[model samples]
Target chain A: MTEKIVVAYDGSENAHDAVNFALSIAKAAGADLIVAHVLEWSPYSFLTKTEVEERHKRRKEELERADKAIVSPLLQEIQSSGVNVEVMVKYGHIAETLLAIVKDTGASQLILGRTGQSSLTSRLFGSVAGSLAQVAPVPVTIVP
Target chain B: MYNKIKAPVLGALASCALAAPAAASNIDEAVNEVFANSTGWFVNFIFSPFPGTTFPWIVAWLVVAATIFTVYFGLIQLRGFKHSIELVRGDYSDPNDAGEVSHFQALATALSGTVGLGNIAGVAVAVGIGGPGATFWMILAGLMGMASKFTECTLGVKYRNEYADGTVSGGPMYYITKGFAERGLPGGKPLAILFAIFCILGSFGGGNMFQANQAHAQLTNVFGDFPGWITGVVFATIVFLVIVGGLKSIASVTEKVVPFMGVLYVGTALIIIAMNADKIGWAFGQIFDGAFTGLGVAGGLAGALIQGFKRAAFSNEAGVGSAAIAHSAVRTSEPVTEGYVSLLEPFIDTVVICTMTALVIIITGQLVIDPATGLYVLNESGSIQTVGGNSGVALTSAAFSSAFGWFRYVLVVAVLLFAFSTMISWSYYGLKAWTFLFGENKVSDLSFKLIFCLFVWIGAAASLGPVIDFSDASIFAMAVVNIIGLYFLMPIVKRELTSYNARRKTGEIKKFK
Candidate 1:
């Protein structure tokens, strides 16, 4: 079976670094690269009806912006690298959604960039990389 | 003992604003008279009683509609109760689904709209007028009203208009017109138009003014008597900022704050109830005895039933079709799932929260009792005389404060959050109805928001009598038109429910967990 390398990307410089790292690993193993971006969303948030009605439109716009502004340029630059690459964007917690993507894709390994500073929420809860490293079924790599 | 304890505690934090200046009083009186005089006819017409009976026809209209929907749907509120909880828990939701709103968000929004001053102040009015017996009828009406919500919301989603821009609009207006035309019926547009007009009025009355009035009442209870216009001005400014100013940040802050307040309010009630643990049975007994015998309540059995049904409809808005506007925004392949989800709204608003308020009032012995005759003390006005001359939110606050003097302070904060959150939600609902009638545009949107903000001040400046009468009438007027359309469109919902149930049985609809 062909190998799959899952990379969590959020369009930051750190994410760019993680993508570049994962690309090298995929090339060495002759594997396909899966790029996943997860928008942080909690279902528990209270919203007004107007907000609720406008959410789907906002969500579509966000997804389109992420693809066009963030992923497309990266994809174009990586195209000449001669590796099969795909992208997935979804709304959910970054760590949980990325882990789900890892399992769903049956990837052989998981990789992500580690940010130098953690968000207050991440500090209160746990950081995404820290969470993924502990729970991922496959081998996990954190690129600094 | 409770009164003595409360007085000194409140005295320490009392404001000197108790005495209003002549100028403010003059303005308040003028605004109050103008509003009361102008809306008198509309209120009277909507609340007109049936010939030879004291029962308002509109209350009967809602109760009858709720009863019919209950029977028509085979008590779906009970049969589908488990599934409704599961649907709200996201058990049947696909995480990757591209739905506009989750069941939880839809329910929460709708709840925020319905579960406000109505639960706090409206129940006080019901019990204050109809005695503890009103509680029994209120819960019964709430249970049956669930089915009404189920029908309207199902039709709301099924007939909703989805735009290319990914935005959607649905409610009685969309469903009435679309569902009728789909069934080859004429006059759907006219009925939908009527529903929209009443919806706008309802939003102004129950959704805007009543909330303002009660918030002011609770404030006055804490700070001492002040001109309503003072409270009105402050409320209008804040509402104008949020709704018309498009200060999304303020709206978001309230959204976060209101849910916390709801939990806090409920937690406080639970604590008060637990404190008076022995009175639990006695409170239930009062509720039951009042329900049947009326316990010297004016109009007795009929009076209790009318007040109960009226307050429940006002509070939960089951057949009123306003919630349909909120529920229609939910994202689901099967519109019936939203119907199931909508059923829980009345259950939560009326059965759980409203009942809690009633129990707290009764348990705390806020209602004055005639020890000699074993009946509620009635004043010259023929309504039960409550402690502290309290009415509306003041009465509910008094009940809480009676348990612990400091509870009134916590209640004041909760009441403000509830009232403010409700106004914000209703502004959107009214705007939706307004845009539907005048055509969605910046001009119409600003016009309605301005009018709504104006009413916030008017509501606070005006006396509770006219404001509440107008609120009850306008909201009930929406029910009158919406229920007529529901009768025409219910078969469509039944078919959806049948297909949904069959699909669920065969595992066509996947359960995620």
Candidate 2:
């Protein structure tokens, strides 16, 4: 069976570096590459009733926007490469969701950027890379 | 990204913050004059008394409607109450559903909207004038109002406008229009239009102004008697910052803090009641005695009933159709689940929380009970006299402070949080109605937000009497139009309930937990 390598992507420069690192590892190991984009969302967070009502709509808009502006462009650039690539977009905490994807895909390795968007939030709440490095079942790499 | 959003918002808030204090004196009178003159006719028309009776027609309208709903729904509120709790606990929820809100979240948000000044200040006003017996009526009205909420919310989900964009718009207006058209009724559009108009007015009076008025009253209770416009301007500035400045962080912070305030308020109330543990029996005795006998108050039993129902209607807003908007957002394929969830709102808001407020006021010896006649003592104005010669939030504050001095400070914090959260919820409801009538665009949205914030100032600057009266009248007007639609569309709700129940019994509706 072919091995899987997962990379966390957030359309940041460090994310591009992480993706390139993951792609090179996938090529060497002859493994499939998985590009995962996790929107930072909390089902537990409190919201106004109006915000709650409009949440589904906003989620849909955000997903479509991300796919169009971030994931699609990356896919185009990487399609000509020999490695099999799959892109996943989900709504949840970045670290937990990426780890879930890693477990579900049975990937042998996990990779992510050292810094991405929402650095301030990461600084306050602890970064996704910091979280996954401790708990990930697979060997983890932090690409700078 | 944080700085990108904060810079503009802080700039706007700072400018308004500076301007409000500087122009306070003249702007205060100008705003008051414009508001009273423009809204006077609408208030008077809505509050016009029934011929040969002192009771307002609007209050009678709500009472009759709630009664009809109770009978028509076969007391669904009582029968489905356990199921309502179950639904709220996520017993039957499908987590994978595409709906925006969970049953618990929807119920919580709706409760936060309704469980504000109405429970605190409105209850005080009720017991202050109508006597402790008003508590009995308030509880009864609250129970009956449950059926009204269940019916409207069920219809709200079934008839809501679910767009391809994944958003929804629902309330009395949508149900009236869509339900009527499906039933082959011709007057749906006109009735829907009328309901929207009443809803907008209700939002302004009850949602914006009443909250501001009572928040100002509580501030005055803590501080000395300052010009209310100062409170108004300050509230208006903060509210304006959140609503128009797109300062979502403030709004979200307020929402998060509100639930804690509810807990604190209720916990403090329990402490006060425990301190007066000896008087619990006598306080309840007074409620029963005052309710039936009127205890020498003006209208007697009927007067108690009127205030009880009025306060309950204002507090829970069951038949008023506002809560339905909040409930409609729940993530349930079974509309009946939302209805069941919503039935818990009035139960929690009125029967539980409002009762606590009323009991606290009674047991703390706020109302002066005449020892000779076993009746409430009345001052020269013929209104029941309280210990501090106060009313509204002040009376409630006095009752709490009588038990624990520092409790008043906590009460002030609770009042501010409650008022702020309620205003935000109502602003959304009012904006929906505004967009429904004038069309949804930036111009209309901005116009309504400006007007709503202005009323916050106006509400604070105005006296409690007219402000409360207008608030009652406008909110009751929403019940008038909404109940008409409920009367027409209730059979549909009954059908939904029956089918849902049948499915649950047959095990077709699987329990998740």
Candidate 3:
């Protein structure tokens, strides 16, 4: 039976290792890979839908840049190894969005970098990885 | 009818006034009796006991050591306060920094670890025994403690290890060893080894056992006849699950729960105080009077001061290096930023929450025990009993119940939440300390967690006299070892501060978003 693994990615070197780790496991277990990039917006500030959409567009470009710089390379390596991969990009709360993606994709496992580029407030409040592990419906592997 | 109403009210007030001297006498007698009966047990089982009371003595020693570090650092806590905030606000925040959590999250997680049952129960005990004067001393100690926290946390960040994988691990053990090694000290390894041993011991008793014991008591008390073993098992199991997941899981739970619970408890206290607005003035008056006069109890002003200082020290745990372990993981280039945020911890824990507890006890006029007879008369038994042999929870409960009818339920909920959250956070502290001593491997981790969980059950069901006393001592002991490290390492902290400030001034560092 094939398993599904969701890997949380940012363009950091650590995220690259986590992506590779996820790919290795995906290959070994013959699992499906869902690469997730969460686009965060400050909850305290107000912005119009048009403004949010504009920001989202900018964030999409950033994600695309990361995909080219990091994620795409990792996916290429995995595909060359004959592993199936699917990429996901969403704009919302990191933890909530990751958990939702896991549920939506029926991911049996989650692989994430130990730390990433979240704002200090979110980090202090906790990371998407920490929060997801606490309440997520599956096992989480924090690649460090 | 006016006479009838006046007479009853007067009678009630008179009885309340009369009850104090009596309760005081009773407590003295009980203390003497317990001391006499428990002396042998204390000597045979606790003093030279397996882990021993030497650990707590170490904490007291840490307090002394921290005091020295504060002086050596030239009272950096005061000078660094404004700068600490600037660091948090990203005046010096570095987004590309190589650490696990943000500076704010690091402080929050660390604050979550320290700001628990100590704030609620410890304050009540101080006010109940030390009189209202204790609040003043507690506030003073809290202020001084900020400096201590600043020193230790600054060192925590400065000496932190940014793992090849980007996971950060740092604390007293890392700094004590790493700092000494850098200095070319001959006994760096030996001293670091000693500190690690003490930290592991302190963590097990103070962080792990004490928290679990308190949580188990509160849970059993609220749920009713659930059997303490059940509470212990459930708590231990949950702790195992989370701890098995390591620091990230612990951080996540603390980040969410700490703020939510802090708000919930503090908000409730605010409402109660507002309702008792008339007595608020009197409460303040009592605090000032008791603090200065040492009135209503024997042993005079000195006794009151000791109680106040003791409670404040115990409550915020500012000087204690245990909190630094949690704070060390914060991702920041500037160490002082975390130090400044750390200052707010004691303020919130002791100044705000503790003051609320003290006021609740004082305004309700419940601090008195008869000097002659020494018995509590308000309740029929004339004696207050505590589960697990520690009086912290019972004392707080009585104070809350007296303030609002049926709000005792609120207190029970608050206590359980406070204790439970505290236990989880402490588990992380102990685990880190354990890894420092035993090596960071799965075997070492599992063994420590297993022992820690067992103690939770023991803490819940066993007599508290030895356990709590020992735990309190252990907590203070960590401060002793940590303060020593901080003292020797103060020069480094000063250098870091100077460098950070210089960067900020020159506009070399930009604000982090």
Cα deviation of B147, candidate 1, in Å: 0.2
- lDDT by residue (B166-229, candidate 2, tens digit) is 7888888889999999999789999889989888888889998999989988987898777777
Choose the strongest candidate by TM-score. 1
* Model 3 lDDT on a 0 to 1 scale: 0.65
Candidate 3 lDDT over residue span B40-157, tens digit each: 4433432232253222233234346546656776776677666666655545544223122344555555666677777877776666556677787777777667777777787887
List, residue by residue over A30-143, the lDDT tens digit for candidate 3: 888888876663332322111221332454466677668766776766677677888886655678778878887888998998775457866678766678779988999988
The interface RMSD values of the models, given in order, are 1.9, 2.7, 13.4
Candidate 2 colliding pairs: B133-B291
What are the RMSDs of all candidates, in order?
Answer: 6.6, 5.1, 16.2
Supply DockQ values for each candidate.
0.60, 0.32, 0.03
Error of 1 at A113 (Å): 1.1
CA displacement after TM-score superposition, residue A50 of candidate 2 (Å)? 3.6
TM-scores vs. true structure, each candidate: 0.95, 0.83, 0.67
True lDDT of residue B185, candidate 2: 79
Model 1: how far is A126 from its true place, Å? 1.0
